[model samples]
Target chain A: MTSNDKIIEIEVLRYRPEQDEKPFLQSFKVPFTDDQSVLQGVQYIKDYLDGSLSFRWSCRMAICGSCGMMINGVPKLSCKTFLREYYPGKITLEALKHFPIEKDLIIDLSDFINKLESIKPYIIPAAPRTLEQGEYLQTPRQLDRIAQFSSCINCMLCYAACPQYGLKPDYLGPAAITLLHRYNEDNRDAAKAERMQLLNAHEGVWGCTLVGYCSDVCPKDVDPAAAINRNKLNSTMDYFLRFVAPRGGN
Target chain B: MSKRSNEPIVWSLFGAGGVVVAHTMPVLIFVTGIAVPLGLVSADVLAYERLAGLADGWFGKLFLLVIISLPLWQSAHRIFLSLHDFGITGGETFFRVVFYGAALWGTLLPLFLLVGM
Candidate 1:
């Protein structure tokens, strides 16, 4: 909006399924201030330069977890990434890597959604109780166990950064497993045995060779890599214990 | 989707091996290769007669077995997974057999060598 504002080039990867056989890079130059984010730059292109540009973003403050994309080959939330950091150099924007692009900047997240559902991301009560039985109280120490993992907003950035998930799509990738562990760590939850069966599989935590990039790309500081590795110890114990006591577990 | 895998059996071995390699191998290397040669430890501490005597003992044989065998499993698992990371998808069963078979051989060879002494 200022006369002294500088113009920057944003090279966006475009793919219209009905129009193009493959994705291609298209550039747009837009004037912007130093404080503006990459999301604003894309919005400018949509509002002023081209109306057909497609992307998903709901919360501009980074909490809604919808505006994630590949910014210069790294997974990042557009709303949290500043364009001024790359002012002189042009920036490349692509859909999250390792996922099929549905449109220009949107990716097909149906696989991620399905995995999220399979984890049963809810507290299965250790014992059923009526409303009059009162609230399930947890000490701060008990809360600390799963609090860090609960920060995941389902952004799927970890999946984009994971080499295992890229190689094996059925590997039950990071965010879902982190969420799964969050519920399993709850004191009131008795579903650890049931969830352990899913985690004990070949494609579960073992699929992760501990490449550890999932934790690096997490904007929310949710260390899915730690969650997966911790569960590996539990899974290992379960694997041996099953031979001795087939019907016994937490 | 919830079918169990035999990976835990191997992974536990790999994990234990990794711990031994990480925690003990350096100390072992330094003590034998540098400490004795540099006289930080007396040359007589690792004398050939003493080392042979160690190899002849049951406990020392167990220690040598653990030190030699576990690291083999660790290195093999690492290599097996590294190959997969490099996008080598074909002949997976063949690769597993060869790599793990080599590790098993390494383990057994040490056990026999130490016990036979």
Candidate 2:
């Protein structure tokens, strides 16, 4: 174990909306402990060394889902990634990929939220259930089918890895679509037909070029790429079988 | 151009074809082709006895034909997609050509083998 007195070489992406026209990288050396996270290292610079540097974070423990950034060219939550991983080496920190820089590490995630809204992101039953019957029943196997898809904390790491979303802004990126699937698979939810109508659009599942990076970068192993791909298969089958079975979208 | 990932259609076809080629063609040579009949003796019996038994009869021929043809079509389809991802845009006609070619020969092989003189 090395002392915390050592300075770690950090090259961070810097952008000033009020000053600079575009984003660029700036290097700084900050002394940090092995126990400290990259977020702590950034805080050290912001608090003592350079107040001009800006990034977003809260909870400092990785739960807030607010501190995702491109660390060493990979999108990760700064609060979770250990500084010891890059000890004695130069690391380049940048804003999350695929979104325009709002300032330093901040990105315009408004578009992402809008896509989230597009899916309705809630349960809508085909018919209202009576109070006597209680909630819809689902088996463990059914839950397993979509439970792994539900662990996403919306860190947007998957979006940063998806080249398809970067190339096409209109494409509904991984995180939001994964949320859509969360509700779509719920047995208590009867809106598969309605949801499928929205999800089958161009900006929906079809927009995915299947770059597969979304699954790779996902911290929760939600496999949004697989979700979208499987949904595509389902939607296509449902559409083709529509004539044979008039109510087949679900 | 954007890179496509391990979509099942592309990968499964490619993989199954590679496996079949590695496992099947060599057996055909020692057991039935110019090697076995001419006593070239350049093959393994235990390595292929079970598989050879299956391929000896009509049912086996049918199974082999189905497996081999499907993988070829799949490989062709995957290769086309791989080409598209690499930004080699020769147009959709290339796909149509493969489709029609697959349609033409994909069925013809079974028809030829099953109903041959």
A1-250, model 2: which lDDT tens digit per residue?
A: 2463778898989999999987888888888776889999898889877899988898887667789999999988999898889987888899999898898998988988887887778778878789997987789998997788878788888889877676668777788888888888888787777767656666677666567888987766679988887777766666566668879634
Best by TM-score: 1
lDDT of 2: 0.75
- The TM-score of candidate 1's chain A against the true chain A comes to 0.98
Off by over 4 Å in 1: B36-39
The residue pairs found clashing in candidate 2 are: none
The TM-scores, chain A only, for the candidates as listed are 0.98, 0.92
Deviation of model 1 at A175, angstroms: 0.8
- Among incorrect, acceptable, medium and high, the docking class of model 1 is high
Model 1: how far residue A225 lies from native, Å: 0.9
| lDDT for each residue of candidate 1 in B16-38, tens digit (9 for 90 to 100) | 99999999989989998899889
Return the top candidate by DockQ: 1
TM-score of predicted structure 1: 0.96
Tell me the alpha-carbon RMSD of every candidate.
1.5, 5.8
Native contacts recovered, in order, as a fraction for each? Answer: 0.83, 0.00
